[model samples]
Target: MDKVNRFIQFNDESVETRKLLLYERIAQALSNTPYMKVTERQLIEYQPKEATLAISVFWRHRTEEVTNLGRLSDIYLLSAGFYRQFDLTAWRTFTTDIKPHSYPKLARQLLMLLEEFRMMESIQKSRAGTQRAFKVRRDIYAEFHRDRLLSNAQRGFLADALINQLYLDIHIGMTSSPHDVFDRLPIDRVRQVAQRIFETETTSQSASLAFQIIALVEEFLTGDIVLPLYTFGEAFEDGKPMKQSSKAMESEEQGESDVKETIEEEFRTWHRETEEEKGMHLEFDLQHGTEGASDASDSKPGNEDAEVQSFGTGRSEGNEKEIGAQPEIEQQQDQSVEPTLQAGSDYGHAHTQVTFKVMEVANKTDTSSLSTLSAWRINHLPIVRALVTEMKKRLERKRQYKRENLTKGRLSSKLTTMLTDERPKPFYRKQAPSPELDAVFGLLVDGSASMIDKLAETKEAVVLFHDVLRELNVTHEIASYYEDTFEASKEQQPNFFEVMHSFDENRVDSGPAIMNFEAHEDNRDGFAIRWMANQLGNRPEHHKFLLVFSDGEPSAFGYDRNGIIDTAEAVWETEKRGISVVHLFLSSQQPTEDQRELFATMFGNKTASSDSVEEFASQTLRILRKLLAIAVQ
Candidate 1:
């Protein structure tokens, strides 16, 4: 009681000013309610029917966030907008004008609930035409009442009191999906909502609840989803030197929880899987703690703390060159008016980049942190983390082993005297020049009808390429092609392409064979291979190249050998613009005369036919280093 009394009496803010602030907050909340009359004239005839879809989508995200925020009641009238309904005391205050002696908890709860609901909810289901439309009406009553009462109390209910909740919802509803309600709203709503939310929220996120709420909001609002390109900067066999986290990027993502426990669990699972596969070259095994290894100085000579710091995932900030330096492809329009990355220019290979873009249900600015969240949650992060960690550990092992030998005046097989300098150099491939395409590299894979037999094998090839390309600061775009040619042009260069007979993209299992769940003539590889080559042909930079696997379907980049039909000649014209074609003919049949001629011309060697994508990809990997070296050089 004294806490509340002391807070009000000593906090010298004027009551009248607070009252005005309260009205502003109520208006903000009311603005978010569907079908609310912005002007007095609209009130007479404006039926809120159109707002139903927005309201439904908004309510969906609202439901999830409120539940997680521990403020479900605020979004739901089930227990008076709380996960756990409050007592009559909460109602008494709202139904009557008299304020309670100490309802700080109620105010706080309402603030948290409303903040979560408003921020996360945007793409609401329309109740206007449905039987349950009345429920949204009920929600408006509860939400508006709570907001109004908090304002009338002449106090800032939550730190987010000044936030424009309506704008936040509008931002969350926008998407390319015709069903999304955000298309009707102005994009300014996203910016305005983000600003208000950012302003009203605490300067620092202090609690787990705050983090969760922030994460949820981010997941719901970031306006676009830019699929990450896996780079090669981090690629190396286990036991080789490890790159510093800052070298490649704010190493792509992880959470703040028991990361070690998660890591250990992955370790165990990895070992089990490898053991099951009878790993020929690699398998996980726990190392025992060696005695006398405590302080940094006491660390084994080669396994020094500096060599392989336990990589904790972080964002693109430490010495960040650029974070997603260029804008996304979908937003690219009127390029001459608005500058964009030139064809084959540095579009995805900046070693250090920091992107400020965020993602969410509706994809607004307020939910931007979710960009990092999604990045953190990416499966590649841990897989790559473990890969990098394992690489780091092996390097440390190799280092310590060499250090011991050096003390004894001996040498290990891993080290060889370098010609450049007298210093011992590890047996590793020379680092390639940065392709310098962008702050990120995008690998758009073609998975369509013709690419069917090669699909399974291409999986590893994609991951392997992803590992190297991402490490090298490159992003990729992989999609299918069947009959129809896929195209995405960024001022006459590849941006992101996906077209399987003109149907929309659905990532994996996308072609006629995969989607129809049946068979076909299987000549789709011609169009698929041609499309990939054409996409690569648009690039002006020689450094950026395309790695494609096909069955040699008599396809030309655009035309045969030298004709305009050959996009390859155009693609290959760049300084290092090479298309190192590798085909693992996943067909049991021997290469026919035409097929042999095609494969021989495209890939240097005739088809080495296989039945699956895995074996073919692995077989292809062995030759990749040489082919890539030649291409980039």
Candidate 2:
């Protein structure tokens, strides 16, 4: 394949991979059946009449397009319901006994619908959340079939009654319009049919039951059972005609060949009679030096000289002004329109380009230094453990108001009141620990040339950071950013933003990706931060933290002084959207007055600076504690 085709294929595979991974995580959390598994397949691969138990989702309906958490939750609930209740072996045996040739397609379809309704009801009884998801899905399905049902109703088709029965079954007790045709159906009869199907001992019996129900509905429709037929009068009121078109009077319909082009054109002379006369007069004056020419001879010589000099100077100034204005106009147009940046490619973004290269530390001794740092962190694990414990406590407190669970820590005030207010006995309950954390972290490292000297220390600090977060089971991503030196230009930004690690349950293996980080080219801090923020912003996490590791101000082509302002603005925008952005300065030397002011302007009080490589780990830990405190609070 060519480059374009290869790029498209890679993106398609990446999306599918991400979706499969997400599905696996959800299944692991919710599926109790040991053999249950879920995978993605193209919708076209599955036959319309196939009876296999699998979910068919289009590529466009991936989790990223919808609410990822909710979509995954719904998928899990559906999968779990199928796994728990759907006996594949029994279903296969039943299908074999009945045979596809013996079963009517309509009867099979009705059986499938009944099975889906039963599964949803069963799952909803155990999970209140699943109830909401099922309701949404049912409503969507009903809307999709609304037109077909209406058309069938107009034709007095018995299948319309069956579909309406399914709709009424799904929306059993929900409030609906009084005039709705489905509401007019015998709801109790529909319920009885559904209950009978649910009580079937086997899939074969269920199919037989479904066919009987269909026959009964057909007989009822053909017999005295009166379905309230929809009428045009119900939708529109009688009214007088407002206007009539000319075509309405035509007795014969117009054919395509009868149509003709309606456009007409006329041409007129350009010069008018008065304009031609004036042109002749001007020519006569130029040829014979007429009376009009003598009028200039009557002017004073001094006044004429002044006018001549003023005219010459104005022409010179006009030429110079035009010359100076051309570049400014082009610059204004350039600034007014920003080119779109295509992501997930090496040389994509108009202002930034990205490439993946193995990270190399200049000093071989730095590897030993990293080992030494790791040893120190191991010794200090007790302190880190204490910090983690405290942070979890705060998180638990924050989550208490939103959740109710049995706990031994305290008595339930409401329960106590109910039991002791009238009686002599009191009741007590304990709160359960929160099931999940509501935070996600994004670590953005500056990969500019200036970071080369501090690369080793940064790597060690990042590895330790990863370890700490892993222990806490926090969802996070680590990325590095720098300009692509060869492709960098003022007009086209070729900055590279590399993902060292992604947010995944299996984050323990991120050490290798992080270790591959190496400094490169220049840095565009604001653009890189915005890109990272976009990644974190779409996440369902309540508390988002984007930590930036850089030495000084952003430096890139056309980004020297304005880069600082842009970075500050990007930070403010991120924080305004409920994300916390913290800057970490990695210079070993003491920060100068200028550095302090610049850092303060970019990060306010959320900025932390390390004096040397030895203190990198300690400083990072301190900064993380501060960040966690703010997030938990």
Candidate 3:
């Protein structure tokens, strides 16, 4: 029976994964932002700065399509419509005015609740497809709040009951309170104001209405809000509106009290299911003499008195300049434009606390390094030449086309008779003899410790990639990445991308610098891909390609559970920006079926497996040929 239950649980998880993938694609399309992602949380919230759209998991029990679609539509409306139109300055002013009121939290919840109606009305009028989903939402909420209204009124929580009554009236045309317990309250005036929810067009206008209603009803309230179930998300603090907090804000209402005691009390009084209602709590602390204390000591190779660097939500000057503006696709128009990178935008939520440092290869000009480069170049010169020849032939074939009758081009000797006869079309043009490939490439070589034995062959393949691109006059960047696992801790993990060649140094003779590459501690594939994609997205080339060379394993500090999913998401986001990604699996013998399947899931079908050095070189050339062909075409 236990095995059978486990099988059922696995199937349920599989279905959820597939559903989340589909929803993510929908979010990317609807938001018109390539980096926009959908995730599951306790409530429907939109974090614009993080580019995350979270749907409430409470409604997951409703397996009907209408309920699911309505939930997704709610996130879409929050992300695309309300986030842009809401006025943060006005909201802050309102919150300050009501901060000392008897029902400050209830007043804030009322404002959010009213804003939803206004936003839904505004967004649904613009998008026709959202109509049915919203109808489902209205029907479901109408039923749920009817029961909540009766319960709150019976407990003498007038303000909370009033909120429920207002919601029912606005959405479902309910009149008066459910029980006649609010005879002294100004129900008629409140309903008159709530009726204007459909009339208000902006969040500021909704705030005005909410303020008026709270003024008339605050004196009748007694305690804190019975259940702040109508919140959109966390209120804006510190001026960065719609940004996500790294710490969980869902536990704030419960304070720092005993979790079990608080939950038990709420259950006994309200008969409420508050367990899943409260989202996950996260805490970070610095501990001394823990399990892995030696790993954090300076006895490691590079951790001797090193300075601790910090990564924050704010963008650095360099990051801003690197992620400058580009063309954005119009959401309403049917056109094909490459996705743009907003300044300081992150592709996925992983590695939010991680910092990346771009470094040059160490000891590049040292005597031993120079000697190694010279000998290495001598050993691999033959294969590099051969690969260059094969790639150039393919590129030339793609560039083979001619125009015999052109008005303005190089004069052809064969068409001289037409010119003599005073014909208008006498000139002919052939393709440029040495045309530039309208493409840029980024090669991210894995620097994990697992690559130690394969470093020699890997360098050969990399040198071939670099030398050929140089021969063809194409712009490309080659770098290796790794994390210092020995020195890593919970609060901070530093990743490095050591550059052997950059696009700006295309004219320089740095081919020998490729010999300085070495295997390092660990590899975080998703973070590395995202960093490289950010660099490549700034280029003006028409075609962009990112090639990753690894053994299809992503291992790093605190990256075990979501490593594969995050890597796949990074690949999807990069491709959405019109950059093609291909993976090459390096191994000695043939890869097992599991390995191949893993690579396929992460990289899609654009993957190649190499069994030896010769096969690696050949596969690298083949991938380049395909990319160049796409570029020329």
**Model 2 bad stretches (over 4 Å):** 1-380, 393-432
Q: Candidate 3 lDDT (Cα, whole model)?
A: 0.70
Clashes of each: 87, 14, 0
User: Which candidate model has the greater lDDT, 1 or 3?
Assistant: 3
* Span of 10 residues, lowest total lDDT, candidate 3: 262-271
lDDT of 1 by residue, 1-633 (tens): 001112454442211222222322332243333111111111111112111100111222245333222222222222112111222232233323213313322323333444344323221222122213233443543465445434532443222321223322323332222112223334343334333443333212212232333333333332321211111111111212222223212323333221112112222333333234221122245678756646676555554456664544434445433433334433332231222222221121110010111111111222443343344336445545554454345434444442322323434454534444465543433233333322212233443355555444454444454454344333343443322224422212122223221112212221222122211221223223444555555655444344444444422223221221122222223213455444455443444554444444434452355544445545544444444344333
Better of 1 and 2 by TM-score: 2
Clashing pairs in 3: none
Q: Every model's Cα RMSD, please?
A: 31.3, 28.3, 15.9
TM-score of each: 0.24, 0.39, 0.54
Q: Under the 3 Å rule for N, CA and C atoms, how many clashes does model 3 have? A: 0
- lDDT order, best first, reads 3, 2, 1
Stretches of candidate 1 off by over 4 Å are 1-446, 450-454, 471-473, 485-496, 499-542, 554-584, 588-594, 603-614, 627-633
